[model samples]
Target: MAKQALGPIRRSFAPWDDPEAKPLIHFRGVTKRYGDFTAVDGIDLPIYEREFHALLGPSGCGKTTLMRMLAGFEEPTEGDVLLDGASLKGVPPYRRPVNMMFQSYALFPHMSVEKNVAFGLKQDGMAKSEIADRVAEMLTLVRLQDFAKRKPHQLSGGQRQRVALARSLAKKPRVLLLDEPLGALDKKLREATQFELTDLQVDLGMTFLIVTHDQEEAMTVADRIAVMDQGVIRQVATPAEIYEQPASRYVADFIGDINILEGRLEKGANGISRLVVPEDGLVVETDQPVESDAQNAWYAIRPEKLRVSLDQPADIAVNTVSGEIWDIAYLGDVSIYHVKLDNGTIMRATTANTTRLVERPISWDDRVWLTWDRNAGVVLTS
Candidate 1:
């Protein structure tokens, strides 16, 4: 099969030279409700120009509601939704300088790919010549030029998704809103599309706001993520910051797998605090000062940061506990070992699978010691 060629890159008329560039999208105490139930509550957020922002959370967390309000499909009950310093209070979805790619990829099965992409331009009353040029450019940009004659039923899932993306981008909107753009594709295709989406956003230099429940997908594609729950924003930060330094137990548990241990903080003479886990009788030192009452505290640790071995290290002086390996799982790239302590508390440790042999240095039911550096764990006050 001959590969489709992307047309010559057109210069974007997007404004980038303004030193005092206002935010592309701004929400001030924005609240949305459906009669008796509140879908989004008092959200205050700002998305900069050309930035890829993701609203990530589980089901019923108000992420979709927030996106709808921004797209002007739903009106806010309380505050304002602003775009490019203009209030979008009464603007309809069609009038707003934004476009949304629905999760269903809403392509007409009877229409060809080129017609599907050209639909939006035709709706805007664009000239025939201009629509043709734009549609051809968008088809080429998505690498779907060769499939322009094919109907939606004849295209693969990924190709249909690209067609939807091309249609959304054809209008040259100031912002693009995506609702679970990759939810329909398989895992491998989803990963590939994420990179392609990131590249497209950069090349077009348009602000992209994505709402997705997939944490890994958000982390992979977003420049920054806003973790939402119960119609409230939990934490907004870069992917690295959100993963490494979670603000609360909910944020810590939601982003990735973590081991949270309840403990009490003990103050020492050196002005440092030590967390004492009552159940495991393990003491963990922390660099954060204990400013509040040390009665109740929690320690969060990632499984990958922990090290497990058959013999305890004599030189180390940190959190160490001996346990018996309860289960083992080989995941190709890494191996997961579930260790049960004497107190019946199970802790997880992940080790790299470097060798191909079934039997290794450690096996299930082996006596092992789990240890981690003091600074590796984070202390959660809440």
Candidate 2:
């Protein structure tokens, strides 16, 4: 199947950047506490309409608690949640204009797909004909029209998830809350379904707020991700920004595989900065200026940003390190080389497997040079 066109929406949509633009949902000083433990701290967040946002963190980080507050399932111990300019302080879950699709799917075993989808409308006392038409529309929207007569047990995991999504969308909610909705699927299916969910969210033009611990899933589907830790939001940014320009050491380490070398910053001439690692006698130069006043800092570089080669780079004054290739992981698309530097620090370099060769040119225990551009890594101070 052809991929859906989602680039325009992803690239051009920036309502949060506009001062005049109003958000559909606002979380002002929202805090949820159980006994003495704080699940969610005082947070102020704004989710724009038609935006696909994600609340991502590790277990017990309060990502789910924040989502529950928005869904009206749990009231905040302090602060408030507003949807479309209306406060949702005392609103019940059922009365909220948002629907939640749980990880379990919560499908009825005895009811058919169409009947399961119509359950919400029927509870609202909609006419029979209207409910039938809405069910048909939802089934078609999820491409489950052919399985309308099948029960939940008769469908595959992906199909069952679609049914759950269909039922949730049958209400035409203002916002859709997904709590690890694709957790049941295997790796390959989960990847494919991520695209499907993104396409579906765009097609419906409804706001989506998903909570998940899967970093790749959030990076793939969400327009913006709010990374939380210990009930506090660490950073909120687009996927590219989050990956390329992480705000802190925690965020830099959490999102992906990164090599952090602690060193002291030395300001150089002409917009040049150097990170001097005294322990390793390594001097890393960069074109980017250091904004922080702290001399003690860390230079964070992703594994893929480093270049591995047997030959020493022409310029060895900076951004060049010699190491022995201790290990190599041959993944299908790429190979990761774990090189042990002279200072006993192990850094990884990734190379794409572009051609099929019976024997590899690079192997273990080989003396190699890892080089990177001056602008390849970011200087982080925290």
Estimate the TM-score of every prediction. Answer: 0.92, 0.97
Best by lDDT: 2
Question: Candidate 1: worst 10 consecutive residues by lDDT?
Answer: 5-14
lDDT of 1 by residue, 80-195 (tens): 99987889999999898899999999998889999999998999999999999999999999989999999999999999999999999999988999999999999999999998
Residue-pair clashes per candidate: 0, 0
- After TM-score superposition, what is the CA distance of residue 105 in candidate 1 from its true location, in Å? 0.5
Q: On residues 1-382, what C-alpha lDDT tens digit does candidate 2 reach at each position?
A: 3455888878899898999988999999999999999999999999999999999999999999999898888999999999989899899998998999988999999999999999999989999999999999999888899999999999999999999999999998999999998999999999999998999898888899999999999999999999999999999999998999998899999999999999999888889989999887898888877875438999999999998999888878778899899999999799999999988999988988899987999998999999999999998887
At residue 30, give the lDDT of candidate 2.
Answer: 96
